[model samples]
Target: MRVEPAALEQAASKAGALENELRSVDVALHTTAAVRGLAGWETARRLEQVQSRLQDLVTGLANRLGGVSERLAATARNYRDSDEAVRRRFDDGR
Candidate 1:
Protein backbone atom coordinates (compact mmCIF):
# COMPACT_ATOMS: atom_id res chain seq x y z
CA MET A 1 0.00 0.00 0.00
CA ARG A 2 1.07 3.56 -0.71
CA VAL A 3 0.92 6.31 1.92
CA GLU A 4 0.63 9.98 1.05
CA PRO A 5 3.00 12.39 2.76
CA ALA A 6 0.84 15.44 2.26
CA ALA A 7 -1.73 14.45 4.90
CA LEU A 8 0.94 13.59 7.43
CA GLU A 9 2.79 16.83 6.71
CA GLN A 10 -0.37 18.86 7.14
CA ALA A 11 -1.13 17.26 10.48
CA ALA A 12 2.44 17.83 11.61
CA SER A 13 2.29 21.43 10.52
CA LYS A 14 -0.91 22.01 12.50
CA ALA A 15 0.57 20.39 15.58
CA GLY A 16 3.68 22.54 15.26
CA ALA A 17 1.56 25.64 14.90
CA LEU A 18 -0.41 24.77 18.02
CA GLU A 19 2.80 24.24 19.92
CA ASN A 20 4.07 27.65 18.80
CA GLU A 21 0.85 29.30 19.89
CA LEU A 22 1.06 27.66 23.27
CA ARG A 23 4.65 28.84 23.57
CA SER A 24 3.51 32.38 22.96
CA VAL A 25 0.93 32.01 25.68
CA ASP A 26 3.59 30.66 27.99
CA VAL A 27 5.74 33.71 27.35
CA ALA A 28 2.84 36.01 27.91
CA LEU A 29 1.97 34.37 31.19
CA HIS A 30 5.46 34.73 32.62
CA THR A 31 5.05 38.30 33.78
CA THR A 32 4.26 40.09 37.08
CA ALA A 33 0.52 40.76 37.03
CA ALA A 34 -0.14 37.31 35.58
CA VAL A 35 1.62 35.40 38.36
CA ARG A 36 1.16 37.69 41.31
CA GLY A 37 -0.39 35.54 44.04
CA LEU A 38 -0.73 31.88 45.04
CA ALA A 39 -3.43 31.01 42.57
CA GLY A 40 -1.76 32.92 39.82
CA TRP A 41 1.64 31.35 40.51
CA GLU A 42 0.13 27.86 40.49
CA THR A 43 -1.69 28.59 37.29
CA ALA A 44 1.46 29.87 35.67
CA ARG A 45 3.40 26.80 36.80
CA ARG A 46 0.79 24.45 35.44
CA LEU A 47 0.65 26.33 32.21
CA GLU A 48 4.42 26.07 31.91
CA GLN A 49 4.26 22.33 32.42
CA VAL A 50 1.48 21.93 29.89
CA GLN A 51 3.36 24.00 27.35
CA SER A 52 6.55 22.00 27.86
CA ARG A 53 4.78 18.66 27.47
CA LEU A 54 2.86 19.75 24.41
CA GLN A 55 5.96 21.19 22.79
CA ASP A 56 7.77 17.89 23.27
CA LEU A 57 4.83 15.89 21.92
CA VAL A 58 4.34 18.03 18.83
CA THR A 59 8.08 18.16 18.09
CA GLY A 60 8.31 14.38 18.33
CA LEU A 61 5.29 13.90 16.10
CA ALA A 62 6.70 16.29 13.50
CA ASN A 63 10.00 14.43 13.50
CA ARG A 64 8.20 11.13 13.01
CA LEU A 65 6.12 12.61 10.20
CA GLY A 66 9.29 13.79 8.47
CA GLY A 67 10.69 10.27 8.68
CA VAL A 68 7.46 8.89 7.26
CA SER A 69 7.66 11.33 4.35
CA GLU A 70 11.19 10.16 3.52
CA ARG A 71 10.23 6.51 3.78
CA LEU A 72 7.18 6.99 1.59
CA ALA A 73 9.25 8.80 -1.02
CA ALA A 74 11.69 5.92 -1.06
CA THR A 75 8.86 3.43 -1.34
CA ALA A 76 7.45 5.31 -4.32
CA ARG A 77 10.82 5.35 -6.04
CA ASN A 78 11.34 1.63 -5.45
CA TYR A 79 7.89 0.83 -6.81
CA ARG A 80 8.49 2.95 -9.89
CA ASP A 81 11.83 1.30 -10.49
CA SER A 82 10.34 -2.19 -10.14
CA ASP A 83 7.47 -1.30 -12.46
CA GLU A 84 9.90 0.00 -15.09
CA ALA A 85 11.97 -3.15 -14.83
CA VAL A 86 8.89 -5.32 -15.38
CA ARG A 87 7.77 -3.20 -18.31
CA ARG A 88 11.20 -3.35 -19.94
CA ARG A 89 11.42 -7.11 -19.44
CA PHE A 90 7.98 -7.84 -20.91
CA ASP A 91 7.42 -5.07 -23.47
CA ASP A 92 10.93 -5.24 -24.87
CA GLY A 93 10.96 -9.07 -24.88
CA ARG A 94 14.36 -8.89 -23.11
Candidate 2:
Protein backbone atom coordinates (compact mmCIF):
# COMPACT_ATOMS: atom_id res chain seq x y z
CA MET A 1 0.00 0.00 0.00
CA ARG A 2 1.32 3.40 -1.08
CA VAL A 3 0.87 6.44 1.20
CA GLU A 4 -0.32 9.71 -0.40
CA PRO A 5 2.15 12.66 -0.44
CA ALA A 6 0.06 14.66 2.04
CA ALA A 7 -0.15 11.67 4.41
CA LEU A 8 3.62 11.12 4.23
CA GLU A 9 4.33 14.78 5.07
CA GLN A 10 1.95 14.69 8.02
CA ALA A 11 3.55 11.52 9.35
CA ALA A 12 7.03 13.04 9.10
CA SER A 13 5.88 16.15 10.96
CA LYS A 14 4.39 14.08 13.76
CA ALA A 15 7.56 12.01 14.08
CA GLY A 16 9.69 15.14 14.33
CA ALA A 17 7.50 16.62 17.00
CA LEU A 18 7.67 13.38 18.97
CA GLU A 19 11.44 13.34 18.63
CA ASN A 20 11.70 16.89 20.00
CA GLU A 21 9.43 16.00 22.91
CA LEU A 22 11.58 12.98 23.75
CA ARG A 23 14.69 15.15 23.72
CA SER A 24 13.07 17.65 26.05
CA VAL A 25 12.07 14.85 28.41
CA ASP A 26 15.60 13.46 28.46
CA VAL A 27 17.10 16.88 29.24
CA ALA A 28 14.64 17.44 32.08
CA LEU A 29 15.47 14.02 33.56
CA HIS A 30 19.20 14.68 33.47
CA THR A 31 18.80 18.11 35.07
CA THR A 32 16.64 16.71 37.87
CA ALA A 33 19.06 13.86 38.51
CA ALA A 34 22.00 16.24 38.71
CA VAL A 35 20.20 18.48 41.18
CA ARG A 36 19.33 15.49 43.32
CA GLY A 37 22.90 14.27 43.29
CA LEU A 38 24.19 17.69 44.32
CA ALA A 39 21.64 17.89 47.13
CA GLY A 40 22.69 14.46 48.41
CA TRP A 41 26.32 15.45 48.44
CA GLU A 42 25.55 18.61 50.38
CA THR A 43 23.49 16.65 52.89
CA ALA A 44 26.28 14.16 53.41
CA ARG A 45 28.77 16.92 53.99
CA ARG A 46 26.58 18.58 56.60
CA LEU A 47 26.03 15.29 58.36
CA GLU A 48 29.76 14.69 58.55
CA GLN A 49 30.27 18.12 60.07
CA VAL A 50 27.60 17.43 62.67
CA GLN A 51 29.20 14.11 63.51
CA SER A 52 32.57 15.76 64.02
CA ARG A 53 31.10 18.34 66.32
CA LEU A 54 29.35 15.63 68.32
CA GLN A 55 32.61 13.72 68.67
CA ASP A 56 34.36 16.79 69.99
CA LEU A 57 31.61 17.34 72.52
CA VAL A 58 31.80 13.75 73.67
CA THR A 59 35.57 13.93 74.10
CA GLY A 60 35.36 17.12 76.11
CA LEU A 61 32.69 15.62 78.36
CA ALA A 62 34.79 12.51 78.92
CA ASN A 63 37.84 14.55 79.88
CA ARG A 64 35.84 16.64 82.34
CA LEU A 65 34.36 13.52 83.91
CA GLY A 66 37.81 11.99 84.31
CA GLY A 67 39.07 15.08 86.12
CA VAL A 68 36.07 15.09 88.44
CA SER A 69 36.53 11.41 89.21
CA GLU A 70 40.19 11.93 90.07
CA ARG A 71 39.37 14.78 92.44
CA LEU A 72 36.73 12.71 94.24
CA ALA A 73 39.11 9.78 94.60
CA ALA A 74 41.73 11.98 96.26
CA THR A 75 39.19 13.37 98.70
CA ALA A 76 38.08 9.88 99.65
CA ARG A 77 41.65 8.80 100.30
CA ASN A 78 42.30 11.78 102.56
CA TYR A 79 39.14 11.11 104.57
CA ARG A 80 40.05 7.42 105.02
CA ASP A 81 43.54 8.26 106.20
CA SER A 82 42.24 10.79 108.78
CA ASP A 83 39.68 8.30 110.10
CA GLU A 84 42.35 5.60 110.57
CA ALA A 85 44.54 8.01 112.55
CA VAL A 86 41.66 8.86 114.93
CA ARG A 87 40.86 5.17 115.38
CA ARG A 88 44.46 4.39 116.29
CA ARG A 89 44.53 7.17 118.94
CA PHE A 90 41.33 5.89 120.51
CA ASP A 91 42.59 2.31 120.65
CA ASP A 92 45.83 3.40 122.43
CA GLY A 93 43.78 5.18 125.15
CA ARG A 94 41.71 2.03 125.81
Candidate 1: stretches off by over 4 Å: 1-40, 92-94
lDDT of 2 by residue, 1-94 (tens): 4324444444545544544443344323334545456576876566556656665665565555555545555555566677789999999999
Tell me how many clashing residue pairs each candidate has. Answer: 0, 0
Candidate 1 lDDT score relative to the true structure: 0.60
lDDT of 1 by residue, 22-79 (tens): 4455333444344445455678687666666766775666566566556655665666
Q: Judged by TM-score, which candidate is best?
A: 1
TM accuracy, model 2? 0.49
Clashing pairs in 1: none
Best by lDDT: 1
TM-score of each: 0.56, 0.49
- For candidate 2, the per-residue lDDT at 43 reads 69
lDDT on C-alpha atoms for all candidate structures: 0.60, 0.55
Lowest summed lDDT across 10 adjacent residues in model 1 is found at 26-35
Instruction: Name every residue pair that clashes in candidate 2.
Output: none
Off by over 4 Å in 2: 1-40, 92-94
